[model samples]
Target chain A: MIRSIFIKETQLLLKDKGTYFWLFVLPILFIVMFSSIFGNAGTTTYTIRYFDADGTKESRQFMDTLAQIKGFELAADNEKSLADQIQAVRDGKQTSLLVIPQGYSQRLLGKGAAEVELHRDAAEDAAAAPVAAVLDSVTKQYQEHKLRVALKGTGQSQTGIDALLTAPIQVKDIKENVAKANPVTQIVPGYTVMFVFFIMITMIHNFLRDRDSGMVSRLKGTPLKAHQYLIGMWLPNMMVVLVQSTVLLTFGFIVYGLHLGDLFAVAAVIISLSICATGIGLMLSVLVNSVNTGVAIVQIIAMGGAIVGGLWFPYELLPKAVQWIGLFTPQYWAQRGMQDVMIRGAHLDGVWMTILILLAFGLAGLAVATASFNRFAAKAKN
Target chain B: MKHVLEVADVVKRYGSKTALDQVDVHVKEGSCFGLLGPNGAGKSTLMKLMTGILQADSGMIRAFGMDTRHQMSEIRQRVGYVPQEITLYEKLSAVQNLKFFGEMYGVNGAELKQRIAHVLEQVGLSDRANEAVETYSGGMKRRINLAAALLHQPQLIILDEPTVGIDPQSRNHIFEMIRGLKKEGLTLVYSTHYMEEVEALCDDIAIIDHGSVIAQGSLHEILEQHADQAVYVESDYITEPPQLSSIKRASARGRGWVLESEQPLHTLRDLSQLFAEAGARVHALELVKPSLDRVFLKLTGTALRD
Candidate 1:
């Protein structure tokens, strides 16, 4: 009997063309849409300015080389005023200014070191880091070349020894990647929550339809108890939700390289969430008399849940009071589970609290649904 | 042997509005009992109650001797219900809808397939089984809907307004199916607002109105009380409407006017005199008796429509 019902429900879902499209096609479409929107464009531009005071071939060569790196746009001191030129570079892109002091070559030749001034726009200090790294690399290479020439002037076959001094006396250092937040990545969790929200809304209406069409009453009319009927309707939708979520997660991995850790825990959280959503749907069915009414109710709830649970924006960014309100949303719990699994690399044991919260939601929803269905018998005849 | 259904003093109310007021009804083994009533007469409500789809505010109901309230599933297993509205999956084929409902009823394996085929044939829907219900005509869908209920080979069939809106062909097909089921000894509780259906098929009828059973008896017996008030006259047909003062009721039927009068001979003589005085042609005329239609009209002042 259970198998027959399962088959029947499966066939029913299959026969519904609209559901098939929404369940399978929609998430893939969203993935493609967001991926295109957040295409791999590399990091932000980091501007570096060259203040060449020493007119030697070595310094000019060094200056010319450092400015050639990607995300590095330099200002030559000969064509424009040094401070003004540096200011222009900063204003044009990111103001990361580098100065080559006078007698810098003589100081290097005498086995002495002089400071090269690096000026930066305070607002763009982070953007200057990568550009500084580029300057450091090029300057280090120039210093070694200068050292090799100096050793050649001294004669006495010091070329081999000069080559051996790989570490230059002045090696400018650079190591930073100025990364910017992409709207697409930021909205992934929101989009996922939106998908789950839309699905739950759809399932909720189907649940109520059983009541409106007298399907539930008819099922109850049979030997099946209320709980069984509830389970039958709910399990089919829950299974669909699970399949849809899995497909979305797969897309996340393949498309954006979303590292969803702990497969078992992720699947468990999803299944638990689907169960909870099913319970919510059942409760809706119990409260509403018609499919449209149930849909309207779910729509309102889904919108509220989506907004509060960070489907549109992260709860962390919201005001403290709003965040408190967001915590009440089931979407919040679901999003929390997903973010934890993805961002924190947490195991199932770690997300157990989220799973429990979602389970509590499901249980509460189921309780309400049962209460409402218990009254179905009374109103059915009319 | 146990009776298929017994509804005893079931009282149902919609808020303070009484929908089924202490209504007692029964369908026995292999009997086609008609539940006849006018609109707002609670025929559908009574059917819902009988099928265990609705619970009574008070009183008791039993289907196959099991309490309907607690043992609805057992009762549902024994009976098939075709609701007043064509509550079907319109996107699916007739056979598909049947399969869905059949599965719900736990019919599986070759037995389910055989049952589907048998019912399709029984309802004269074999030719249209694969067609989507939306593509079907009004009558065809109703036939398929009935076929769905019959797929499980239920012991008791409850058809509420099964023929309400259908073509003559479909209506005739449904009546024939009911008759065929009767021959096979399947008990049925047929509810409709149409009195003629009760006259044609029911062994007995319980006429309801205002949430109560106003009358209940065999069709012949129910018609017997109002028999004297009706008189049917068959004529080669008068050229115009015939005036008979003693006619407490009259309706223009085919090839004649059925006149219900207290004095049939006098009315007949008066008809002849009037035709002679007007120089109207009258080939023949005879007084006939009352049908269930007249009996129903007499009992219910308003016609059976909102």
Candidate 2:
């Protein structure tokens, strides 16, 4: 019976021209739309380096150390000039770069002064000057060590001066799992969840289109039981949803070097999420009996889900209360789980909570849908 | 199978209105039984209950020896229902609609294709099988509607006014199809307001009125019950309705006026004397037997067309 329902649903869906336009074609159009609007945040930045001419040992140390920063797309350019590199950043051809110069180290040993010139891209923050100051501090510490070496040659006490140059208590920097991969990996899972949510909720406009078409009354007469009939609707819709997820995820894997955790685990989550969304569409189909009503309901839910789930904006930036409310939406859980597994490289055990919560959401929706269908059937009856 | 369908004392209600009140109907095997009634007569309601689309509030409905309430699914698998309205996806073609319904009844592959081809040809829509239903004519749509029901080879097929409004060609086609189905020994519960259709097609009929079957029997029996129900009138009558006691109830149809009377013999004898005294030329006076339409009027207090 279920098999027959599936075949019938497939045939009906194929026959419906609206399904093609609303489900498959429209999602691709929106992907292009959203990729352009939120491109600034979702994209990782490229790194541009400057070969500054201060030539000091301290300057060289800082130039070599810039690779440690996160989200840096390290690239080599043959422009080989500070002015050219800064122009690149200004032109949006590249992001910010640090410049080091050929400098005379003799000034530090001969006199009590040394000057190192650091030129930043004009587009960068005015805060770069203080960052230059921090670099100067490192140079000053080197000069003092040399001075103490010279004093030891003359038999003077260097302990007090050493304490002045370097603090007695040192600050330790701990490196954990955050800065290990490209920053695009950080946003990929979030984008997947957000896009899926947007596409699913927005695509429910198709359900509204069905009402005026008289397709609902037609299917009701078929031997397809309503529940199994609903599941039949899920198949074609999930085809489009799964394809969208696959396209975006595969792009992430190639371009951003994003990890998908386990192939099986990611696939499992994607498939389950597709099922959940299809069920959501089915439920929406029941409540919104008219095409206009369906469109209105879907638009309202899509925008609301994106807002609450922090798809357009990050939840971390929001206040505590709003973030707590965000947790209630299914998009939030799926997004969180995707982040946990893909961005953070967490295992399946890490997202058990999210999975369970999504399952509950699906079950609850199914129940509501079943009840709504009973009402719909009774109402349509002559 | 003792009988295809049997309903014993079925009563259905909607809120304060009684749709079916103590309606008992049984359809025997290989019988083309028609339940004839007009709008708001609970004919559709009774058909729905018998087909397991709705439940009888206070009675039992059995189809093919099994109870309807308990075996609705099993009965639905074997019973085909074509609703009054065309309940098919308009975007799909005739063949696609047939295939979808055929597959729903567990028909697939070569067998499914064969059945679809067979039914489309049976309905004389084989040439238009690939055209979308929205593109078909009203009569063409009605034909495909019947074809969809015939997909599973149902033991009992119920059509609610299969050709309600169609061209004469489609009407003849449907009449022939019914005759063919009857010959093939399929039990059909056909419903319609056209009493002539029942006369031409139905092997047996249950004349329904107001929420109950007022009369049920063969065509000859119903006509015989109201046989002494004709007015022999000859006159230069007015084109308008004649209001007189000699013609107790008179109406114009087909170049003549048919006036029905409770006392046909006395009314005809008085009509001859009254028309002769009035110096009228007696054109043609014949005592006509009552038809199903007259019987419907006599029993229900209204004409079939009204």
Candidate 3:
């Protein structure tokens, strides 16, 4: 009986083109669009155009220092006129333009202040701000070097000058327990979990349609038990969700190069999430009175859960209250579990808690849904 | 004859509304028992209870000599039900629907396949067995619905208004199918508001109203007990109502007089004599036996469909 019902339900689902689109096409579209927009996270490099009118050693040394800074690729195109560089900046092709004055090195050596001109596009302020800050710090270091050289000339010892120039305390930055947070990891699993809920809408629709059409009463009239009928109703939906998740995850891996650590752990998370989603579908199927009401409720659940549970973006970026509320959604836990595996390279040991929580959600949903289904069957029969 | 189903003082209620009130019924084995009632007359409720889909509020229902509550699985295996509405997977083919329902009743493998083939042939939809039910016509769908019920080959078949919303030819085909089942000695409990269907197919009947069985007996017995014996006479001279002493009630019916009496033979003889004395020849004088519709009207004081 279970096999028969499952096959029938699966055939029905395959026949529904709308469900096919939502299950497969929508998730891939979300992944591809978001990946293209936010693909270059840590790999992005900003170009800085520099021109040196002063060919002195000091200016040459400053240019060398600027070239070694992280995430800034220096372009000292002396052949191109400074006017052309400025035009590039104005046209938004260049992020910023730097120019050294004619007497810069001589002024610095002779204890006279010198100024350098930096031109940037206002619209590129976000990218130009960091370049400007780096330039300021490099200039300050050069001034400090000049001061040290002046002090040495005044007969101060090298050690004393070095100690004075360096601060009494040294600070170092150490990153702790941080994973590689990138757009691919975030959006792939984010949309995967988000689209998993869409399967609930299909499940609820099939359930309500069968009930309203009197098929439920007919099935109950047979010798099949209630649990058998429940399994028959639930298993096919669960399988559809599992297939949807697997396909989306595979698409993410192939297209976006999504890194999944411990495939078994990821599979466990997806299985639990599918069960939870199927449970929600079951509960909603009986709770609502009509197909229109069921569709409305499912929409609220899928779209609302996606927004609140950080499927589109990280919940940590939201307000503390919203983040706390996100903890209440199954999507939050499922997305968190996927992030652990894909971003943190977590193993099975790491995601067991998330699996258990999702399982609890699924079990609770099944309990309430089963009770409601039984009540519905009884009422229908009467 | 052995009793296939028995209901004694069964009462079923839905909140404040009583759907079945002190309903008692007995279905003899190998006989077609027609449950006659108007809409909401407890026919469906009683059918559900007998099929073990529903439980009575305060009474016992036994089918196949077993309690419905305790032996539901056994009873379900022995009874087939065709609901008033189409209960099928519209997207699935007739054969697929039959196969699935057959599996639910523990029929599978070669047996299930053979049953599906047999039922599709029985319903005369063998050519359209692979077509989706949604693509089939209403009569074809109804045939598939009946085929689904017969998949398990249950001893008793309970149909709730099975022939509703179908063409006359299809209705007659359903009657032929029911007759075929009856020839096989399958006990049938058919409920419908169509009196002609009951009159054509049923051997025994129960007429219910307001959740109570107002009349029940063999077809002939119920007709004899409640139906009026009237002699309809048509004569050229009888333009107005006839005044006959032997007739208890005489009323003019279009170009004729319908005369009711305790002695129908004597009333007919007196009508013929009166027509001869009036210098008018009687063109037609025939005894009109009461139909089930008239019997239902006499018992329920309303039309069968009302």
Candidate 4:
């Protein structure tokens, strides 16, 4: 009996064009659009326009130092005037502009200090702050060089002067336990988990359709038990969710070269997530009184869970309080589990806790849904 | 005859409203029992209770001698129910719908296939068995709904207003099919607000109103006990109406006169002589027997449809 119901449900869904659009087409569209926008996972670089007005050796050396900084790209030409460059910055074209004033080298040599003017748009603060800090470091190095030369000329040994110029303490950064935060890796799983939740709408709609059409009461009149009926209705939708997750994951791997660690663990997380979605769909079908209300409630859950669960952005970047709320949504755990496997390259051993939590959510949802369904059926009899 | 179904003092309540109030009914084996009532008169509720789709709050319902509450699964296996609404999967074909419902009753293999084919043929939809129910006409869908109920070949079939919203041809087709089932010795519980349908198809009936049974017995007995006997007369060239105390009531009816009375024979004899004396020519005169519709109206003080 369960198998029969499952087959019937699957066939019904297959005949519905809307289900095809949501299950296959919409997820692919979302994945393609979001991946293209956030596909680059490497280090980001900023371009700076520089005018070398100081035609001296010290200014040339300072320009060379700026070129060697790790994430700074310099323009090929100094042809644009200072006014033009500053206008470009204000117009949002140029991120930052640097001008080495004439006689800068002479001033540094004579008074040990020379200021180079830096122009930037305040609105581009995210890009402008990094450029300003790098320029400051470069000028300070030039001032140190001038002092070292002056001290060497005063009859200190060259090696001793070089040693004295170097600071007693040096700080070097060694990255530990950090993986590259690839936006593609984060987005594919995040949106996949979020969109899988939308499948609940279709599930609930089918269940309610059966109820409104009187099929449920007819089935109830049969020899089939309630538990068997519920299982029959639920299993097919859960399978659809699982298939949808597989399709999205495969699309991620083929197009974006996403690396998923431990294929078994990935499957486990996805299956658990599908179970949770199915349970939620069942619960909604029994709880809501009408189709319109069911659709409204499902939209709220899907969109709200997507936003709060960090499908649109990284959860780590959200406020501490919001992060606490994210933990309450199923998307958080499912997305985190995917991230653990795909981004962190952790195996099943690392994601077991998240998988367990997802299963618990599924079980709780199923329990509540079953109880609500029993009550709804009883009420329907009355 | 053995009783196939018995409802004793069954009471069902929904929150503040009582849907079924102390209802009692007994359906004999291999007999067509008509549940007659107006809309919301608890006919559907009573049928659902017998099918074990619902539980009574304060009574006992037994189907095939098994308790409906505890042995519902067993009871359901022997009872096929056709709900008032079209309960079929409209997206699926006739064969698919029948096959699905057939399997739910644990019918499978060659037996299930044969039964599906037989029911489709029985409902006169064999030629269109592969078409989706949504594409079929309303009458055709109603027929298929009946066909689905007949798939398992249960001993007792419960039909709740099965002919509603169907064409006359299809309604007659359903009536014929139901009569054929009765001849085959399958007990049936037919619920409807149509008095003609009950008169045509049912052997025994129970008229319910306000959640209780107002009348129940053999169809002939109920009609005899409650319905009035009257003689209808059609005449022309009458200047004054006839005056006879034996005539309980006399009124013009469509270019004719109808005289109703308990003693219809004496009333008819007196009306003929009176029309002769009044110099009126009798075009037609006949005695009309009591009908179930009149019986229902007399007992409920309202029309069957009202």
TM-score of chain A of each: 0.64, 0.65, 0.81, 0.88
Tens digits of lDDT, candidate 2, A220-300: 545667777666655666776788688777876775566777776677677777766666766776676565676676666
Question: Counting only residues 3 or more apart in sequence or on different chains, how many pairs clash (N, Cα, C under 3 Å) in candidate 3?
Answer: 0
Error of 4 at A185 (Å): 1.4
All candidates in order of TM-score, best leading: 4, 3, 1, 2
**How well does each candidate reproduce the native contacts, as fnat?**
0.43, 0.34, 0.91, 0.89
Residue lDDT tens for model 4, B25-75: 999999999999999999998988888777789999988889988988888
All candidates in order of DockQ, best leading? 4, 3, 1, 2
Chain B alone, TM-score, model 4: 0.95
Candidate 4 chain A weakest lDDT stretch, 10 residues: A373-382
lDDT of 2 by residue, B27-53 (tens): 878888888887888888888887666
The collision pairs in model 4 are none
lDDT by residue (tens digit), candidate 1, A1-382: 4555555566667777767676667756866776675545455555455777887875766666775777666655477777676676568554666778888778766767755777777786666778767767876876777767767777736757555785567777753322323444445655655666556555655555455565565555455566666666677777888887887777777767666767888887898888777778767766776667776777787778888787667678887887889888888888888777776667899899889988899899889878887775445433
Better of 1 and 2 by lDDT: 1
Candidate 3 RMSD to the correct structure: 4.5
Model 2, which residues run further than 4 Å from truth? Answer: A14-191, A195-227, A251-261, A284-297, A368-373, B1-3, B232-234, B237-257, B262-289, B303-306
Proportion of true contacts reproduced by candidate 2: 0.34
RMSD (Å) of each candidate, 1 decimal: 7.0, 7.3, 4.5, 3.2
TM per prediction: 0.76, 0.75, 0.87, 0.91
In the range A132-198, model 3's lDDT, one tens digit per residue, is: 9999998888779878978999999999898889977888877643445678888989998988888
Q: Chain B alone, model 1: TM-score?
A: 0.83
lDDT of 4 by residue, A1-382 (tens): 9999998998898889998788778888988888777675356777767888887997888788888998888873557677887788889987778888898989867865677888888888887898899987986876687788789889989888888889889998876434535787777888789888888788778877877777777888998878888899899889989988998889888888877778998998999899888888888877887778988988888888888888888988988988888899988889899988887778889888888888888888788888888766754422
In terms of lDDT, model 3 sits at 0.86
